[model samples]
Target: MKKTINAPKAPAAVGPYVHAVEANGLIFTSGQIGLIPETGELQNGIEAQTHQVFKNLQAVLEAAGSDLDHAVKTSVFIDDINDFAKVNEIYAEYFTGDTPARSCVEVAKLPKGALVEIEVIAVKKEA
Candidate 1:
């Protein structure tokens, strides 16, 4: 069975997509920008924006009953590659383990002109 995850603590999707979907023990989360859920405002700077994106991802994963520690993979899209190191620094704070497979790329743009966006795939732990 497939399950959809939603959380009020994360920014609402600007497009027609669920925050996350879980099926057969795997959870796939949609890309998260730096929009603050309650204010619908984007965070400031690459450092702050990256932190917000991670926070958003964390919230969605929690809603799906998973977590960053369970993430098997992550994909990050940044508007500028120049900010890669800064983003990576913030990302490392959340993924402090052997670390998950990851891909980072520079894109021409992102929704709401966000500086960065992130998505993850995680496995549900056995009870």
Candidate 2:
């Protein structure tokens, strides 16, 4: 009925939350930041950080037996609205073909002063 998704390839949750949770045919993921899973190091800048965020998201999705291509919705949080364009560029690299519906907004700050964070929802398709 329900399942928890965990991935050693993604950063551990900062709080008491699963990286992703699946119920029925859908998976809901927690917000992912730019922290590298191996070292827990935050990435350098907007470009690098955004890339890392997507990587983290991908890992969680994979753990849930889903992927970005299966995403139906996503929410992106940015520390600076100015970085919107750059983040979009990096984000598009992953979600370009049949991009999931998304909502991106600027926030005053994020946990650990990270530049960007993303949360996603995906559906597992039957073969």
Q: Estimate each model's TM-score.
A: 0.96, 0.96
Clashes of 2: 0
Which lDDT tens digits does candidate 2 get at residues 5-64? 888789998888999989999999999999988888899999999999999998999888
The regions of model 1 sitting more than 4 angstroms off are: none
lDDT of each: 0.92, 0.92
lDDT of 1 by residue, 45-75 (tens): 8999989998999899888888899999999
- For all predictions, the C-alpha RMSD in Å is 0.9, 1.0
Task: Give the per-residue Cα lDDT of candidate 1 at 121.
Answer: 98
Highest TM-score among the candidates is held by which one?
1
